[model samples]
Target chain A: MSTKSRKRMLPWFPGSGAFVDADTAVAAPDTLARVTEDQRLTNDGEVTVASPDTLARDTSEREFATEQWQEVIDRKLVDWGRNPQQLEYEELIPPTRFAIQSAAAIAMLCRDHALAPPMRVVPDGDGGIILERWKGSLSTSIEVARDGTVEVVVVEDCRVVSRQVLSLE
Target chain B: MTSGDGSEPIDKDEIVLRRIPATFEWYNPGLGKPIAWVAFKPNENDRSGISVWRRKYRPPCEVAARNAKPGRRYYVLGLRVALLRAIGITVEPSPLEGGPGHANLVNLSSDAYRRDKDGITQLAKIIAERLTICVDGPFGPFDIDARQE
Candidate 1:
């Protein structure tokens, strides 16, 4: 397909709906802008695909490319984190097999909880895995240690509101 | 400098330099995103304490050069010690041989590694939020082969 008029199935979900995968969960938590074939895509890239029921959005080249971009990036992450040496950095250790497994489990948990899929998922530098999400001034991290212990932390405006080990049973 | 046991304190206004690995969450594997939460995650070997350098003892470029290895380059970011402490995070000097500015960014709790790893990680994010890039460049650090760099 040509780069100009690429057909993209924008992962537009309803505001009250729970996300089933990281793909759609990456959208803003409670706010959603619906798009349809009849909606107009203006030259300025602002798609006024909103009514009282829909929200306004800028379907700029970058924003429209994000869904495809995120998929490619996620695959690239798997390739980059495949082994210890692939970790690239000298001091960085690879995420343990268990840590990687826990990350999957945690991602599933996020979907189950209707929470955003991790905005970023990478090695914890301690041979563990960390799944992170940033919502405005709040940041949440679910770090799994080498031993498979999960610590879910929520930090708001640089202050920690909760920090405790979570038993992923 | 020897290992500090908290008897001596790092001044609040002091700038500390942290070496960001290429795979850092915010760095985005050369994307070099400056999302602070991803800046100071504790190293596996360090329990839950993160390694940082007190810039008061050495310049940032010198610190970067000293820590740089052969194959890859390190990107350093500066954070205020006092800003970290304002959120109850500790910046303790634990100088090692040759690197007198070595320090550990420890959590306030005694049982940090097991119970308070989140606090350590949370503070790391805060540190990331307030971090300043030491090297000159945009987005990512300076690339050797780009823009005649």
Candidate 2:
């Protein structure tokens, strides 16, 4: 793949061996640079996952690690959904339903792309959820803000090489 | 020092000490040692202000008194005031009731990435890079609430 004119430039997964942001693409020119949100929009995660092109795959084996990650999200919803106050040290606010749902959708996005399973999926402590994936020095975090917006951040050895926000409304 | 705008000027020489979220701090094997990028994010509740303590006012060891818990342990990291200003942020002293060292790292520009999250995410990444932890501060997540995941 040549993705020069492709309309759907996926968010940078860093080492997905597929997508890289403009900055990282420079350090490693071999990697394909993704277009900006003005040119690339990944609107509905579910629809993106269910696209016809993604329909052909080995779903059974690939579902294990992702299913485990989903459990963490679901558990947070149960623990903090109703209370909305009894968080760690009784200090953090509960995550909104929109945020939890958005996190799940982001997981699906990663699963469909065959990225490594998330290392952590915790509340942002302000009525939102954060989904984090780690690959050696590179960490990709997708956060679902309280209002259902998704912000994707990729950090390599403490330097944030790419930043993008996707609207899930 | 005043920037002549009435708002207190945070000197570039000051050091900012901030409490790190337990779940957000980690020692990555690939990156070597601890410095979680998530630890530097501005809390949404703050609307943009991330609270910190000025080393000149309160010092690192004394800050724990403001936010100490019974048994939980957490990490605190430091970033220079100049490093933040270089990235277009301001760290002004903001005294709170019984906590005079309290200050906030806020956006100098009102637009400030329009809260699209690009500002915080990128800021946190650089903060993590320049983050420095003291030996006295807790390094691991041993005392976090059992309920936390």
DockQ of each: 0.39, 0.18
TM-scores for every predicted model = 0.60, 0.61
User: Interface Cα RMSD per model, in Å?
Assistant: 3.0, 3.8
Top model by DockQ, which number? 1
- TM-score of predicted chain A against the true chain A, for each candidate: 0.52, 0.59
Worst 10 residues of 2 chain B by lDDT: B140-149
Query: What shift in Å separates residue B6 of candidate 1 from its native position after superposition?
Result: 16
Question: In candidate 1, residue B86 scores what lDDT?
Answer: 77
Give the poorly placed runs of model 1, Cα more than 4 Å off. Answer: A1-77, A88-90, A105-117, A148-152, A162-169, B1-13, B28-33, B106-111, B131-149
lDDT of 2 at A128: 72
Model 1: residue B64 alpha-carbon error in angstroms: 2.3
Give, for candidate 2 chain A, the lowest lDDT window spanning 10 residues.
A32-41
